[model samples]
Structure formats: structure tokens, C-alpha cells
Target chain A: MAQEERRILVAVDEGEESLHALSWCLENLVLQNSKDTLILLYVKPPRVVYSTFDGTGYLFSSDITAAMERYGQEVADVVLEKAKKLCNNIEKVINMVENGDPRDVICEMVQKLGADVLVMGSHGYGLIKRAFLGSVSNHCAQNAKCPVLIVKKPKPANGNQ
Target chain B: MAQEERRILVAVDEGEESLHALSWCLENLVLQNSKDTLILLYVKPPRVVYSTFDGTGYLFSSDITAAMERYGQEVADVVLEKAKKLCNNIEKVINMVENGDPRDVICEMVQKLGADVLVMGSHGYGLIKRAFLGSVSNHCAQNAKCPVLIVKKPKPANGNQ
Candidate 1:
């Protein structure tokens, strides 16, 4: 008989915060003897650079393109690194990068992978962009088929709990 | 005039799902625009339901007793129901249900109340209960604050945009 594994799909971004959220989800949802999937999501927002691609705006250029790729790779690396250290069973995890809106990708991936839940940081690299787009996290929560765990960034260390 | 306020607080309970989640928060968070205090909280596990007689348990019993008393009064229709309804602005939101555990309380409340930035839901409820006490929500997203919404229930009937 297959084990009743809880599929906790963690969504990591470009900072320590998303890792922290994934850590929480791992601890809370993925119990001992349960299967867990920690998916690292490094989403590169759609960039419309006025490049010479068909003489229209396509996201490919010298610095902007390189910088975007660099940032995307960095995000994936950092998030996965921190997450690996934070997770319990490393064998049940996977990490990768995607290009598009975080919310849409998150929802799509959740459906595609049959993710039971989504774990994410509340505030991430694209706060301004999210606000402009009416909140990426909000869109994900409203649209995603699975449950989402929203983690708040910890305050600068002080007496705050 | 109201400082362009934007926040939504939701009290979550896992069993409820949907309208009890982000939808509830979104519905009520937008209730007062800038003045809204979006608080998404899952009340911690109710301290062991000690009877109303001994020690620290007395304090909690008093609160429950008060709630029960009010419930009774409303049932009898002796007191003006509208008075209680009109006096508390917090009670106006839909899809919020009070649960025995603090975790459920915070999440459902926040979802129903619709706060802008969630004040406390994950750690406060989970950490407070501890492993022995069995607080589940504690393991949720730990960095979700602003634009962070909660959902104790499932999605609404009309579907989210």
C-alpha cells in the first residue's frame, strides 16, 4: 500500500523569506513518513525590451537580458540552497526557474503537479509589481486549486515575537 | 482622506475552506477602504478546556460564559438583537465563524474581517499551542504580512477573477 504522503508544494522566490515559509510548511504539513515536494520557483517577470527581434518589443538584449537571466539564476540558486538546508527529506524535493507571472505559474504548476498546498512568503521581490497587478499572491490564493500558506517576513531582530 | 489604506485581515480554519479564505478577506477588507484593519488571524488552540472553577481556567471560562450568555439572550429574543449587531462593526462581515481552537479563530476571523495586512495567524496560533498542544496553523507561511490573505474555507461560487 502506498503511504499517505502529504504533498506540500513550496513556492520559493528571491530571498530568505520564501525559504522561511517553506521551512514552516515542511515542519507543519510534511510529517514523518509522508512524501513532500518542495518546488523552488524563480519567476522572471515578463520584460518588454525594445529589441531588434522582428523590430518589436521582445525581452532579449545586452545588459537587461543578461541581468534578467543572472537574477533568475541567482534567485533559483539562493532559494534552493536555503531550502535544502531547511528541509527534512531532501530526496522528495525539486527546484527550477520559470518565466512569467508568479501567480499564474504557481497556479499552473500546482495543477500540473497535483500540489496539495502552496507555501510562500508574503512580501517578495516583486511587491511593487504585485501591487500594480493587484497583488500576485492574492491572485494565486484566489485562483490556485490548492491551499496556500502565506508567510510574513520577520521583523528586524528585536524583542518582537 | 483615509490615507489610501489597503489591508485585509482574515481569521482562518482549515475545515471551512473557500469563502472562509481569501474571498472572505477580500469581501470585508474592502468594506471600509482606507480605514480597514485587515487582520488575518488563526486563534491558537484553546487552552485545555479546563472547567470554569479552578485557577487560570476561570478567566477563560468567564469569556466563554459571556459569549454563551449573549447567545442565550439572543435565542430568547429578550434583548434587542439589532443593538448588539449594530454596536460591533467587527461582526458585520460574512463567512466568519468562531472556533474552539485559537488557530481556527484567527484564520476565519481574518478571512471574514478582511484586514489589509495580516497581524497574526501562523506563528501566534501555532507557536502558542506547541507540539504537545497541537497547533497546526503555526506551520503555515511564516512571512506573510502585507497583501497576505488567509482562507479557512474554499473558493466562492461565482469564482475569483
Candidate 2:
């Protein structure tokens, strides 16, 4: 039987965890399949709307906001560049950058692009911290339309191992 | 760099959803790798303790209890048999049957066997239903040491598609 080409969407970020996931996917899933498309997605945080006055009663300047946006773009570029190097052997690679919350953007893109699988990296945050700050991977796993693969970074080798 | 042989543990059950996940794994992950080990795990519900006298004032016979155990084994056999057929092309396949809660069992096995990837099927229950009856896949995805892949069965294609 002929195999259908698959679109594997991988969410990348500035963190090492996401980069690790991309490498793992490339090694395990992408290296063997020349037909599959590897989509590297980086979601920038939504642009902040600034009022005239800041919380500290300081004047909010447009320059500050613009600088922040530029920084976000640079970070996205660095992440996508690192991910691309890992996919050097892959034939079809698509780089995408969307500005929004990572969780929502990932879920939406998976459905819109008809992705066969969504690969993400676990932050490995503690329970308390995860509750205070929402986990993007966990949220995407619950809400995404396609299969979700959460790749965990293995712990450093202990003497026992 | 040569890739390391990976142990892929797939959690199977009597439900069609799990069988579908096994099929997906075979097509996507197992076919290309001859050295990778495919572990097919089927977790049976823990045996119930039967009292001599029932709450309804009926006596529970040993025969009835034995028959229930037999039925459970039969179901596990049927599921394993069907899964085996799907895995006929694969060279290394290991069948495992354990009795316990599936969520706990799967998480424990992944760690004990040092599985590289754990594949499971999403029941795809709605939010409310998922809340009432806890989702096994969700629990394992959060707790398992290895990467967890939750394969969701694709919805029936509509005429427009």
C-alpha cells in the first residue's frame, strides 16, 4: 500500500526544550521520510497595547513598544534558524511565525493546516509553577485536533546509570 | 550519526480506538526500523473481590467468579490477536498483559522498561465526560517519563472534503 504524505507540525521556541524536541523529531520521524513536510512554528507573544501612562505613572513611549516587538522577531529568527539546521537532511521544511499565545496558535494551526501530528516539548515545570503559569504543551495536548506528541528532555546522566 | 534502537511501547485495549492507534504506529514508526522493539501492552481491569453473600441476598458461587475471570482473559486474547495481525510485518513484537488501572499501569511500565516512546489512543470524550470519567491518555502524558504520543482517530470524512 502506498503511504500518504504527512504534515508534521513542530512547535519551536527560544527554550532548549523545544529545540531538543525538534532534533528528536528530525532523527526519528523526518530522516527516513523524504515526502513528509516538517513545519517549524514559532509563536510570538501578542503585541501589548500600551496606555498613555504606565502603572508606575511614567509616560509610555511608542519607541519602547517597537523595540520589544523587534526583539521578539529576532528571538523567533534565532529559534527557527537553530531548528532548520536540525532539518538539514529533510527535503520539505516550512518555517512559520505567528504572533499570538503559543497554546492557541498551535491548536489553531494544527487544524487549519490539517497536520497529521503535533510535536512539542515539555517544560517540566513543577506542579505549583504550572498552576500559576499555564503550560503551553499541556493546553495544546488537550485542545489540538490532531495527535499530540510531548517530548520530554531526559535528565542528566547520574552515576547510577 | 547512527540512530539508537528505540523501544516503542504501545498501550492497547479492547476498544477500537486503541487498535487504531496501533495501526497508526505500525505505519508511521515501526515499518522502517528493523532493530526497534515494539511492545504491545494490554492492561486488564483489576479483578474484583467477591463476597460469599451479595448485597441483594443472593449467594455468589465460585463458578461465577471463575467464569468472569475467563471472560476477561478471552477479551484480552481477542485484542492481542487482532493487534498481532496488524503487526505481522514487524520483526520484533512483544506482547504484555498486566492487571491494574490502565493509567497507573502504563506510566509504571514506561519507566520500568525504559521505553523511548509511549503511544496511546485518545478516547476523545467531551470536556464534561472527560471530567467525570478521567482520561487515561491525559494522565499518562503528564506523568510518564518518556515521550507520550496520543493518537486521535480521525473523524469521518465529510462529503465536502
Candidate 3:
């Protein structure tokens, strides 16, 4: 029987770990002459909600918020551009940008896009930091409907554990 | 450049979830005419240490311990047999049985065997049970040297969350 085409969704970010994961997926998962759809998803953080008064009791201006949103878009564009270069040989590649908490957005997109597999990068955070700031890969692995592959960037041989 | 062959390690057990994961890997990850190696690993729980005196002060015999050990081995054989049947089309396949805490044994074997990717099933335990019992897949994903793929069995259409 002929194999069905798969939709592989890869979560990309500004971090080197994410880019490394993208390269690994391209090398290992994407097969030659296969009609697989590679979806590159970059999620921007949700817009910061600011009250009229700042924490220091100073009035918050709309211009600062607009600038921040613009910066977020620019960062997304840069990351997507870098990711696109790595997929030049792929026949079908899609780039997407969404705004929300990455942990939630990634799982939602995987279902929304009917992804066959979800590839992500592990931040390799220590216990303390992971407890304080939750790990996105961990959350998605537990929540995503499809198979989730968490790619860890190998540590330096000379580095400490 | 020619793509390098990869060693893919899969963890299996008596659970239906694991068998489903094996089928998923065979369908999605394993390629035809590729020289990839598929390692099927089944981890038997460590032997239960029995004291001379039982909980009710009854004398415990060596025969009981021996029977338990035999049962563990039999279960491993059964699971490996079932998993092997799914990989009949694959060119290279290896079956392994180890006795220890699965979370530790799996991570150690992934490094020891030089596996490129580790595939396992997600039990999908609830927050309360997962917190108390700990998740082997979660631990391996966090600690393993190579990438970890946690394949979640899709719930029934009418199943509760």
C-alpha cells in the first residue's frame, strides 16, 4: 500500500536549541521524494497588558506598547527567515506566526493543523528553574494529541552535568 | 551527502498503550529500504525483596521468590514477541530485556546502545496519579542523551478527558 503524506509541525524560536531541533528534524524525519508537509511555527509572546499607571505610578503610554508589538513581529520574521533557509530543499514548507503562551499555542496548533508529529527543543532547564518557570516542551509532550518529539541539544563534552 | 543510518530504540511493556506506540513508530518513523536499526526494549520491574517473615509474621519461602522471577521473565517474553511481530517488515530489529527501574534503565540503555531516538508510550495518567507514581516517559525525556519521542494513544471518540 502507498504511504500517506504526513504533516510534521516543528516549533521554532530565537533560541539555538530550537534551530538545532529544526536541523535534526530535516535530516532524520523528512525523507527524500516524500510529499510531507513541513510546518514551521513560531509563537510570539502575548501582548503585555499594561494599566494606565506603571508600577512606579507613572502614566503608561500607547506608543511603548505599539513599539513592543512591532519588535515582536520583527523577531518572528527574523527567526522564520533563518528557519526557512534550512528547509530550502523541502518541497512543501509553511511558515506560521501566532501570539499567545507558547505552551498553549503549540498544543492548539498541533490539533488545529492536524499534525502527524510535533517536534520541539528541550530547554534543559535545571530543576529549580523548571519548577519556577514551566518547560514548554514538557507541557506539550503531556498535552499534545499527536506524537511529540523533544530534541535535546547535546551538551559540551567538557561541560559539567 | 548520503544520509546516515540511525538506531531507534523503542520501549515496550504489557500495556496496550505501548503496543499502540510500536505500531505508530513502525508506520511513521521506520522507512522502507533504509538501514535503520530498531531496538525493542522491555524493562521488567526489579525483584520484590521478601523478608524471611511475611507482613503477618508468616515464614516466606524461597519458592515464592523464584516463581515471581519466572513470571517476570515470561511477561517480558510475551511483550517482546508481540512487539516483534509488528516489525516483521523492518530489515534490522533487536529485542532486549532488562530488570531495573524503567526510568533509569531506559535512559542508560539509550546512551549505552548509542540510540539516535528513543520511542515510548505515554500512559496519559492524570495529574494526581502522575504526581504520586511518577512518569517514566517524562523522566527519560528529561534525562536521556538522545531525542525522546512520546507517542500518545488517541482516546476513544466518546472517551472522557
Candidate 4:
């Protein structure tokens, strides 16, 4: 059988760490060949809980929800655009946007797409804070169907945080 | 200036998850080229509280501690040997054994060695359990100077754990 193209799914957000991951993937994982496809995924948490009553105490939930959805889509487009610009071979690029919890959406998409690997960026939360706030990348690492790369931005050499 | 070889550090243990990570690295990350070097690291937690009372009610802490140290070294050797055998190019492999908390040791070594990437295997702990047990891979992902890849073993097809 002829070899299939490698599918690399990268989870990107507005964070600098996510951008670093995309850059690292381009420099290290993405080969200069036609047999690789890089999928840029942006997961927006569903805005169903944002519904609230307006000034008159009447429900304006639908209008607010629609606006939130549009905002989410805009964020996805901007992040994907920046990721595409960083790629040396934009021909292999594909974009995906989904509305759900990122921890769940990422793992689900990896299996649904049959991706060879899933890449993400660490939010750089310390142990105590991560323990309390919960880390999406850490959750995905444990639950994802394929291999996960959680890229961390390099620390400055001066030993400053 | 010519590009320096990329240093890839992989954390291994007796668990199948880690060995799965090593296999995935060889298949996906390591290319048939001379510009990449793989470092296999096994961190043993320091045996500080091995206090023991021997026969005749005498303390045999020193002897027991020595024995434990030896056992730790033996385990390291076995794991490294198995990892080396998995690689097609053993010439580019290096083994490092350190004694400290795995989370602290892994992150420290990544910066000290100037590794381009650090790879590890997820233990598949869920959020509640991981929150208490404290996952090393998750901690390293947050703190490491370089990119971190936490490889998860593929789940069974039947959707059973």
C-alpha cells in the first residue's frame, strides 16, 4: 500500500505558548514534503451559560448567545490566520473550529480525524495553581487517543520569571 | 554557524506507557539523519527516609540504604538497556540517571542539558486522581524550559478502559 500523509493536529489559542508550539512544530515536526498535513484546531467553549436577562428583566439570552458565538468564531479566525502565516508550506495547512470545552474537543477531534499526533502548548501554571485551576493540556494528554506534544515557551536566560 | 544537533530527552520507567512513548518516538520523531541525538533519562527519587532497625534492635539504616541505592541503579540500567535496544541508531543515544523528585529532576535536566525537547508518557490519571497524586509529566510541562511532549497510549477500540 502507498504510504498515507501524516496528519498533525495542533491546538492553538491566543496564548503565546500556543504560538510557540506552532513554531516549534514547523521547525521540528513538519517535514518539507508533500506527505504531511498540518491541521490547526481552535476549540471555543460553548457559550450556552452566558445567557442572562436584559435591563427590563426580560430574557435577552438568544441575542447575547448569538453575539458570543460570533466573537468566538472571530477569535478562531485570527489565531488560525497567525498560525498559517508562520508556516513555511501553507499548502499543507487545514483549519478546524469547534464549540465545546477544549479538553474534550481536542481529544474528540484527534480520534475523529484519525490524526497521527496532537500538539498543544502548556499554559505554564505552577503546581499549586494547576492543581486548583485544572489544566486543559494536561487533561488532554491523559485522555487523547494519539500522542500529545505540550510545548512550553523557553524561559529567559536571566533567570527572571 | 552550522546548526547544532537537536537534543531530545525522553523520560522512561517500568510502566508500559513510558515504553510506548519510546516506541512512538523512534517511529515518529527520530529521522534517519545525523542531526538528532536522543537522551534516555530515568529519575529515581532520593531514598532519604529508609530508617530501619535490624536484629538485636540495632539500626541498620546505612546497610539498607546502600542496598536500596544499588537496586535503584540496577533498575535504571535495565530500563536504559531496553530503551537502547529499541533504537536503530544506538550510537546517538545517551543515558542519564539522576536521584531526585521526578518532576523536579526532569525539568532541571532539560534546562541544564539545553535539550530541544522533552518527551514523556502520560500515566492516564484522571483529573480528580491526578489532582491529588500530582503527575510528573504535567508538572514538567508547566515548568520545563523547552517543549514537552506527553505521549498517551492509544485507547482500546472497543471504548473500554
Write the candidate numbers in order of decreasing DockQ.
3, 2, 4, 1
Clashing pairs in 4: none
Taking the tens digit of each residue's C-alpha lDDT, what string does model 4 give over B1-161? 11357898999876667877888787677665547889999877655322322326555667777898888788789888887888756458888888776778888999899898888888622223233347877788778888788887656763522
**Candidate 2 local lDDT, B6-123, one digit each (tens):** 8999998777777878887887766454588899998776553223124475655779778878977997899889988988887889999998767788899998999989998886
TM-score of each: 0.50, 0.83, 0.86, 0.81
Candidate 2 per-residue lDDT, tens place, A55-134, comes to 57565477987877788799889889998998888889999999776778889999899898899888622232234437
Residue pairs with colliding backbones in model 2 are: none
Can you give the lDDT of residue B33 in candidate 3?
Answer: 75
- List model 4 lDDT by residue over A126-145, tens digit each: 33223333688878877888
Candidate 2 vs candidate 4: the TM-score winner is 2
Reproduced native contacts, each prediction: 0.19, 0.46, 0.52, 0.57
Model 1 ranges off by over 4 Å = A1-3, A49-64, A125-134, A157-161, B1-161
lDDT by residue (B84-161, candidate 1, tens digit) is 232245433332224355544444444444443452222233222344444334322322233343443433753642
- Using DockQ as the measure, name the better of candidate 2 and candidate 4: 2
Candidate 2, lDDT over the whole model: 0.76
Q: DockQ of candidate 1?
A: 0.10
Q: Which rank order by TM-score, best down to worst?
A: 3, 2, 4, 1
TM-score of chain B of each: 0.32, 0.82, 0.84, 0.79
lDDT of 3 by residue, A30-149 (tens): 775788899999987655322222457555577977877787799899999999999999999999999877888989999999998999888722222234447988889889999999
Give candidate 4's error at residue B120 in angstroms: 1.1
Error of 2 at A85 (Å): 1.5
Best by lDDT: 3
